[model samples]
Target: MFTLGTYQVHFLTFWCFLKVKRKDRWRNGSKKKFQSQVDRETEFLDVQESDQKLNFKLKGPEGEIQQGTCRYLIGAGGAHSAVRKSLGLKFEGGDYNNEFMLGDVHVKSPQRMKGLHAFFTKEGILAFFPFDDSGNFRVIYGDFKNFDAAKKDLTLEELQFKVDQVGPKGIVLSDPSWLSRFRIHHRMAPCFQMGSIFLAGDAAHIHSPIGGQGMNTGIQDALSLCFKIYLNLRRGAPFELLKGYEQERLPIAKDVLRATDLATQFALSNSLSTRMVKKWLLPFLIEHTPLQKKMAETISQLAISRRDQKIRSNLKIQYP
Candidate 1:
């Protein structure tokens, strides 16, 4: 049993088309079916554990229930929308008090550019990610706790005021297609598995989407969980084999949560000292070659290392 929406994807391709194609032709059909049918709103209610199988219920919107039992269960419900208590897993993590506002905006700008622009200012951090189109952009503003207090249906004037509070001059917002407020969080479950039932994606871990890692990490979790299940099915392995998945993946998830938590804090810090550090000191430090290289690697997710490498290398060395 696997909750959907935790599959690995090619970022560039997925962002461009919002679709994922399986690398294996045989798997493509099943993948498409899963993608088409999975419901994000449906919640997993509970998993009843037994000696040889696990029984679970998925509750639909109208109180309808779907009952199922399987030898294995994979919980990929996601970090924010996790059904952990229903699955009998323990979660451990903290929250970042900072809130952020994000939306897509249409702008007529004096400057034409592609790529991401980040503004670190006395008010907060504002970032603009240009879309494939020239006039459309994804804008993000951070550090305003009462962001919700602003106009709910943000008018063009309100949006422009918010943007101007954080950046260079002459940036105007003509129209906004989407807008929403979010709080940053960094947390992970203490365990990713309990017996035959396993947690994946946000259910097991959650972090700030600062480096665009939340979705990516969740997708990787799904891939890893699927691989482990496939191996167990092929080898007729005991459910004990699945425990290794949690042991291996949980630490990595914790690391990601920690890093993203720091990034969120740094992005939203509004204290006078932090403002000075971010606006003035950070850029100066980043100007150094080594610091720039390190920052690049960190944001690119190149710094994470799976314990599998050590396991593989040790096995090879011992065998040789």
Candidate 2:
């Protein structure tokens, strides 16, 4: 991934084929954002609405309960968000049938490990991503068929098997730091705001892991929500300021989900014709300079815009 500036661009990772998350960056940044309120486990139990106030019941690990009332609540809970569930908001998409295995392992590769590499064969698709200067690589094995069987946990030997099957011959996977099997979903909440509670991040939308836009989109939601709330409370702006948060972000989420779905479909293609297209057509398309620049911007999420959108505080915001 990359961040383009006027004169210089920062290469966040060598992987452009797929977007990868750097947990350390998120953890450190979040720590700096909420300096004092760091180690709290907040279990949201219920949200009650009475008169004009919304009361939230939260439970702690020790069974301690607390209640707080606010005019607005922002639900940043991840996928399967309780807040969105309480509001009866359903995600709008289905899970992909294919399953993928991901793991971070110490790998020694003969080929240049600086950039992301995808080995596509009739067997399956296996991609390796080098995260840092170290040889620690994130490997993904895509199984478009045998969904049920592929859902099983990945073993070290199984990782080796997959590597031998699709990855470069000399590359060796060992000393895995993390391993898991998962199925990806593409879903977005119909509406971001209901009453006074607003859904953000995974609570709002989720898509294939291809572009890794999930967390980035959610962080954008938090920033927009916070700024709107700040304006309404501190500057005596109308609550309509918050409506722009949804108007601006929801479409961006939809576009991201669409992009991810397309990329994932191409990556996980199993049919002969699709495989040929992926093998030949895709590389040809990506070779074009203009298309390459556009893909970079789209993958980096620099193309999302809301120039024509207007902020309206009169928009209905439910609190319960």
Candidate 3:
């Protein structure tokens, strides 16, 4: 992996493959790519929305111009969504000032990195996620004191220097496969839909990677939308039936945005008081059973409550 611009975040320039989270786990082969994963090669030039249909213009893989029209548009195209921009939509959010870095490597230690492991330090926050039992890990670190750290051409040695300061003891990161420098944000679009065109995923909202909520929330956004679209198209439902998409999803997005922004600030805070809170308060809170249960429910989306999507039960897609 190479460097990616701050706006271009999360699975932006990779092999365009990842997993969707289910009740059990998030694991899938390269062939089972997320429907929303857009390989970096594609570019959106412009999008135009209308009463009858939406017109889209884009640059394809081969540097050729392309244009098309569709009756419905769902913008799952990440933060810089073409469809959202075409409609003059506001992606309303602010960026976290701390410069951050991430990469995949193997941690040389016997400790099982089977799940998320966060190391809160005086410098910033270092998080490790295990890929498998072979010690492979995805490491994310925020540099609170070193804002001037190189933004591009990030090296494993640079990462090692920082990891040695903040990472788990006796665990050495090695055989680095990918490294990247990026900034994160806490923001959401003001609305999810306008007319027949709609926005979902990062197109509608984006937040810090603190809770690992980006893809899971976006997938849920698509889920809230897909059946609604089916009802409108296949079951002769009213277009107004689709407005429930925003009603159902906007609150969830708003809540996620608020929660993540707060957590990120708390995690990456440079203030001495906040660092003390992390050092003292957070560890105790982490061990709280109710808090753990709430975090689990929120991560799995079981705690999400829709406002106006009860219509889903009455509406079903009759496959022809």
The candidate that achieves the highest TM-score relative to the unseen native structure: 2
Best by lDDT: 2
Model 1 lDDT per residue over 1-320, tens place:
11111111122222421111222453567668678465656777778887687887888878789898888777766664445777555667676666577777766666764555677665567777666566677777776464444435545565577776656567777556667677666777777777777778887777787877776677667766776576558645445546667777777777778778777776676677776676567656755677666666655556765544443353342211
How many clashes in each candidate? 3, 8, 0
Q: Write the per-residue lDDT of candidate 2 for residues 39-143, one digit (tens) a residue.
A: 368698778778989999889878899888989988877998889988888888988888688888888878657656666677667776666667777888887
TM-score of 3: 0.81
**Candidate 2 or 1, higher lDDT:** 2
Which residue ranges in model 1 land beyond 4 Å of their true spot?
1-30, 33-42, 60-62, 80-82, 144-157, 174-177, 235-241, 287-289, 303-305, 308-320
92-141: candidate 3 lDDT, tens digit per residue: 87887788888788788655455556776666778777666667778889
- For candidate 3, list the clashing residue pairs, or say none: none
For model 3, the run of ten residues with the poorest summed lDDT: 1-10
Which regions of candidate 3 deviate over 4 angstroms? 1-42, 61-63, 110-114, 146-150, 307-309, 316-320
